[model samples]
Target: MRIVVVGGGMAGTIFANNLARRLSSELKAGKARITMLSASDKHIYQPGWLYVALGRMTPDELEREEASLLEPEIAFFVDPVQSFRLGESHVVTRSGKVHEYDLLVIATGSRPVPEDVPGLKENSVHCYSAEDALKLHDRLQAFTGGRILVTVGLPHKCPMIPLEITFTMHDFIRDRGLIDKTEFYYTYPIGRAHSLENVATWASGEFAKLGVRQETFFNLKEVDGAKGCVRSEEGSEVKYDLLVAVPPHRGEAVIEENKLGPNGWIPTDRYSLHMQGDHGEKVIVLGDTTNLPISKAGSTAHFEAEVAAENAAAMVKTGRAARSYDGKVFCFIEAGKDRATYAMFTYQKPPEPRAPNAAMHAFKMAYNQLYWASVRGLM
Candidate 1:
């Protein structure tokens, strides 16, 4: 059986690795083949990028060679997916190569849709991708003072990232002895500081203590690049010397073109990770591309991979129902100044108690090391 995994981000990589290792015997016997398709050779440790942006870690520390993470027998394709033809059970790459598979896994991840907002595509500097993180880092290093506006676009990935950047900038500026010269403003489209109510309450107190101004219900309408300001739907404007924006996110184009969902995301049985459209148990999806209620985070992807791998293996062996996925999400909200907070929850409940301290910061650091080692098959 041939298995083609699309989009080699955290979810794809973890799913492929788990599936390959579990079915190694079948793979060696020529009964199973696993292939991973990605658009870039680099597999960035995205969670680490937040620390890198804060100068806590270097760019080298946040990057890993994608080849090192895959099993030796698995094939790797470094190319963009042009589209997916579900009826034909094949995927066409940007270079016109067609891949046929008995089982398909969609983990292509999401991309920043800066074009969703007028002027944002042309002006704002996004902080979601590796390139954007590096650009923001450079911009931060050179910034001496002035208004620094960190705005959150609609349906952004990693909701806490913009908040973290805001806090980190406050601390960075203070460390540079420019606190008095700089003013920090955080704008979010939501009515609260974060999607999670508990997180918003905790964050509001922290922002108050740190003197970071917060504005809510200020959906970003446009970025006045020429005027160096961001205008909200309410017609209010905030000027800035450096604007770190989080653009709206969307599913991969391949999934979009195939009529996966109205929003381009594939609807899946949350616990099983099975694509809703497939009558058989052949197609599965994970990560940001799914309309999962949980936060689109690295940890969520990791957990989803576990469920998908198990279900995929079971489907191959017996015609049994797949297990359900509980919407459990965990996040480390960086509060800057060598401090952070931990929050976790399931879909029905609110965020759990906040674990605030420097130890949480240390835990975040160690988690990255563990992630790298595990993905490289060293653990």
Candidate 2:
């Protein structure tokens, strides 16, 4: 049996490593094979970007060679897929090579589309990518004082980032002794401060204590950079000296070009993690590539990858799937520089975040270093 995994982000890497371990006996007997193909040779810890924006971590600290984290039994390639020929059970790469597989796992992640909003790309600084984080770091460093605005768009990766960034930046500015001189303004697209009700409630109280102004139902429409103000789709306008935005997101372009799902997201079974169509049995979708209504956090990808890997390995060895994904996700929320909290929930339950503590913050910091081990399937 041949299993091909696409995209080397957290989801793909974890799935490949887990499956290789499960099929070790079959691999030694020449009965099964696991191969991973990715666009880049470097695997980055994406969550660390928030810390990068705050000057807590350097970009080099978050990077590792993709092959270094994989098991020796798994084959690795740096060729990116250009087109998906699911009808023929094959994929064409940018190098004009065709690869066939018995089981295909698509974990291609999402992309931030800041340009989707008029003038937002030109005026905002975001930490979605390494370069963007570095740019934000520089901008924050040079900032003296004034209003700092945080604007959020819907369906972004790491649902807690909008709140996390705001809280961390408040601490950052306070450390610089500019907290009093700077006014903090935040906007969300929903009726509340966050998509999750409990998180929103927690964030609202925290904002009140910090004296941060907030506006809800403020969908992004346009930014007038010259006037230093942003307009909302609902005809609301807000001014800012520095704009920090969590832009809207979409799945990879290959998925969109292949028409796998609208906006590059593949229609996937929420429970089985399989593609939702005739060939669904042979095609599994994980991570940001799946059109599941869940938080697009690294933990979401981590849990889904576990289920996909287990089911695929079971099918290869015993001719049947073994388990189903339960929509489990765990995320650490940095309430401030020295304190943190966490949210753990499943499909049937909502997250109940506890009060912030230094111990949880320390654990979150430790987990940052342990992420490499986690990706290698050693956790």
Candidate 3:
């Protein structure tokens, strides 16, 4: 059996590592093969981008060479995938290299579509990538005082990121004694300002306490970067001195070009994570590639990857169905400099995510240090 994994982000790399380890005996016996195709050598710790934007961490600290983390036992390719021949279960690389596979795992994360909205590309400083985070870090570092606007576009990865940025900006400004000089503004298209209803209720109060005014159902439509103003689809408008927003998200061209989802995202069985192509060929997607209607945070990716890996391995080894993910997700929210909060839940709803505190902050700091080891299954 040949299993090919695409996109070497957290989901792809870790799933490949764990899957290969679980099938060690078959691997040694030459009964199965595992191969990973990564676009570049750089493997970034994505969640750390938030800390980067906060000026608490640097971009260099969040990146690692993807090849460095993959077990030597798995075949590695430094090939960027162009698209898939779904019917024949094959992938074509950018350089026209064709590879066939019995099972495919796609972990291609989403991309921010600033182009999706007119004038958006010229307006906000997005903190989704390493460079973007570093840019935001510099902007935040140099900012003296004024209204800081943070808005969230739809279908963003790490849905908690803008929230973390909003809260962290408050602390950042406060540390410089500019908190009083600056007013923080936030807006979301969602009704409660967050995905989980109850959590939104609690967080809204926290935002109020911190003097961060929030608006719901305000979908970004146009940006007037010159005037530091934004107009929402609902006709609401906000003006600020600095604008930071997560643009609308869409899946990469690999799936999008193939007519995968309603809007470039590949739709999968919510429980199984298996995507059925037009020819009835199925591929398992573990991360942002799928339109799962859940938070596209790293935690969701981690859990989905584990579940998908188990199922893929079983399908190859024993023709058995694996366990369901049950929509389990975990998230840590940093409310300020020394404190943070956490939430853990399943499909239906979440617990009241922990209130911000020093312990949670310390926990996050420790996790950052141990992330590589954890993903490599060494800790």
**Whole-model Cα lDDT per candidate?**
0.80, 0.94, 0.83
> Could you tell me every candidate's TM-score relative to the true structure?
0.92, 0.99, 0.95
lDDT per residue (tens digit) for residues 150-203 in model 1: 888767678678777888778888988988888888888878888878778888
Highest TM-score against the true fold, candidate = 2
Collision pairs in model 3: 339-357, 340-357
lDDT per residue as tens, model 3, 96-201 = 9998988888888888888888888887898888898888878888888888888878878877776778888888889888988899998988787677676688
- Candidate topping lDDT: 2
Give residue 33's error in model 2 in angstroms.
0.9
Q: List the candidate 3 regions with Cα displacement exceeding 4 Å.
A: 277-282
The sequence of per-residue lDDT tens digits that candidate 2 reaches over residues 58-160 is 9999999999999999999999999888888988888998889899999999999999899999999999999999999999999999999999876799998
Going through the candidates in order, what is the number of backbone clashes in each?
Answer: 3, 0, 2
Q: Estimate candidate 2's alpha-carbon lDDT, on a 0 to 1 scale.
A: 0.94
- Give residue 158's lDDT in candidate 3 (0 to 100): 79
Q: Which residue pairs collide in model 2, if any?
A: none
What value of lDDT does candidate 3 attain over all alpha carbons?
Answer: 0.83
